[model samples]
Target: MTLKSFSGVALAALAVTFLSAASAQANDISKCVLSGEKGSVAITPVNEGAITVETALPNPAWWNGDTPDQIADGYEYCLAANIAHRAGFDKVNLVVSSFPALIANANQNKDLAMATISITDERKKVLSFSAPYFSSDIGVMVKAGTKVDAETVKTFRIGVLQGTTGAKFVSERIKPAEEKVYAENPAMFAALMAGQIDAAITDTAIILGQAAKSNGALTVAAQYQTGEFYGAIYPKESPNKEAMDKIIDDMRADGTLAKLASTYLADSWGADPTKVPYLKP
Candidate 1:
């Protein structure tokens, strides 16, 4: 019969059928199918048979441990392991490198780098990034009991990591009285503890991790919803980007990403980042 002549129940059944078809279309695997074997997508190795994934050290909740070999536990580390398995690599050569250095060289020294590197239009020029794996918002931190809000944040002396979106936010939005840029997280947090800067701005999860380990010396005073997403960086010329993106998208579509976040970051990050109070900037 004609669709316009259908009864209410018939219309409902037709609607459900249409929705099911749409869902199936959205999850079509053909879009992300691997070019090589199902698991062993051919990838140029940085070290023999291993897929070398570089990440900066001392990244707290995202990457703990002093060295790559001794990596105890963290969300990003777990992600690296999963990537290796899906790519059919028996070994994962985890290496250390700063975010700025990796981005500058476009991971020339490794197969890929997952240093909680955010995906941005500007960075896409120098690096090929996989589908986003994590989302983050900008956060403002201060020594405990040192009060500051969205309005007052602009007046404080701010500390930021060089070449980070947080640093860019501080300069363009906060316009704080003074800005101190550090090449790394440790140095910037140290400056905050020493009273060198009145506030620090960066990813909410990062600041929260620092505050949790600070023993009452620091607190995440404010945050802004910058709607940032982190992506794994592949070399500009790498042919494996498509396959890697498929793998990451699969992980995200499944419950793998959520499980990893709970296993590595639930306790350390405390409250949900989105639930944190948002500052109107």
Candidate 2:
């Protein structure tokens, strides 16, 4: 064959070899797959591996680009994808479910679960967690025209995720007229937008992204420093915990995690972590 033709053929062959290897890896992941709860859906993974990691939404499915049976593009999702890719996992599965559901089925047929889930003493009993990849203060969302000074938030109808740090903060500190628990990020934000709730408390990134996306319809009324960090969840006694923890440690040492944070979150996403303005009623 001609030299140029030979080169082209070689490149094509290399591409085919890569595809074949990738296909083989996917089959490997499927071979080891465990059956998940009824709601979970298989995803076309960025990498192929022996175990399937499951995920709910990024809370804000809008920000994360998560849909049923599709891999999400949110920062948390990206973080999981990166870690799995780094750890030599060839495939991952995505599901859009509430945290309650995700937590309920943690190890049924899934290897890992993520959705900006915070590491907590309570959660440790049921699920193992990798080292922290992200830390943030909680933020409260409110309408653009509302007054949120130190005291005005009490007049605002407030809500938080059912079992989150934000919920703890609201229950113990805010003690609203009637504390509302939302199922997911979008629902909380929707309540705020529709005037159903005057405010919703969530992670800093959610506040930041919502405020930016709302076009002056929503604003971050307040931020509370909860000293919280996000971690990916694994089944209790997960075999991958040690390797995943080491991978996170190495990523931190190499600045991979910070780079990811900046790429996904603004540079100053959580600049302050000590603002406590909630008042117990």
Candidate 3:
């Protein structure tokens, strides 16, 4: 072949190769995203190259409810899936585990934990956290007919999930007259209904969900803007921290995060957290 023709052909081949690689990367991220409702996992191998993502599914409304027998579903779970996909994971193994174990695994550099983990000064010592993706300003849930407010919060019997920011808020800020600790939301909320406690303090999402499901039997009374944002847990120096934070930041910049939260989590949150009414700490 003529030298000029050979050079042109070679350049065309290289161009094709580069385009192919870029296309594959784009394809990877697109297919890696959540299998939104009306989309079928059986048809689209969105998770073909899935990476393990651990989370403690607190409830259907709080976390994704996907089981081995079902598809990935939930607010935080979908949020994690979106961020993971953007970070270049095709799919998430979406393992259900405990919060403590999830944190331990992150400490061990095992898997990415995307549960609704509140960032705190103490946890920052051992774990790297992505930029805040959710807020955990303390919120209150009172039985539907039980009226209360920030000023009188101290007099009511309060239930809070142990070891949570809500528990801390009550213990340190409000110092309720009577307080009870439960292991999880169900237990804490059950106490409220059983009259074991007159109210519950927790993150807005949990309290909103519980109140909604209570069918007017419970309602949110107060929201405290604690400046606590949810951060995904990572190993102390894992590289994923920066990448995950970038993706979350981009989502926020592009209004993607707001849209996701509104669609999947607003019911549980009751309002846009960024603009919602909150109690002064």
Evaluate all candidate structures by whole-model CA lDDT and list the values in order.
0.71, 0.58, 0.61
Stretches of candidate 3 off by over 4 Å are 1-48, 66-71, 100-110, 268-277
The best candidate by lDDT is 1
lDDT-sorted candidate list, best first: 1, 3, 2
For candidate 3, write residues 33-145 as lDDT tens digits.
Answer: 23222111212122344545667656656464435235455556666666655544555566666655665653343346776778889777777777776556667888776
Error of 1 at 51 (Å): 1.6
Worst 10 residues of 2 by lDDT: 30-39
CA deviation > 4 Å runs, candidate 2:
1-51, 58-63, 68-72, 105-107, 267-281
Instruction: Give the TM-score comparing model 2 with the true structure, all chains together.
Output: 0.73
**Per-residue lDDT tens digits of candidate 1, residues 1-281?**
22222211111121222122322212112111111223455565667766778888788767767786567557777666666666776556777878788777645767788877777888788678887777767888899998777778878999999998888888998788999999989999999999999998998878888898898889887898765678888766777788777777676554456655655565786655555678887
Which 10-residue window of candidate 1 scores lowest in summed lDDT?
27-36
Candidate scoring better on lDDT of 1 and 2: 1
lDDT of 2: 0.58
Q: Please give, for residues 56-127, the per-residue lDDT of candidate 2 as tens digits.
A: 565442235556445444456555555555555545566456777876754455657777777778777777
TM-score of each: 0.83, 0.73, 0.75
In candidate 2, which residue pairs clash?
47-90, 47-91, 48-90, 48-91, 49-90, 49-91
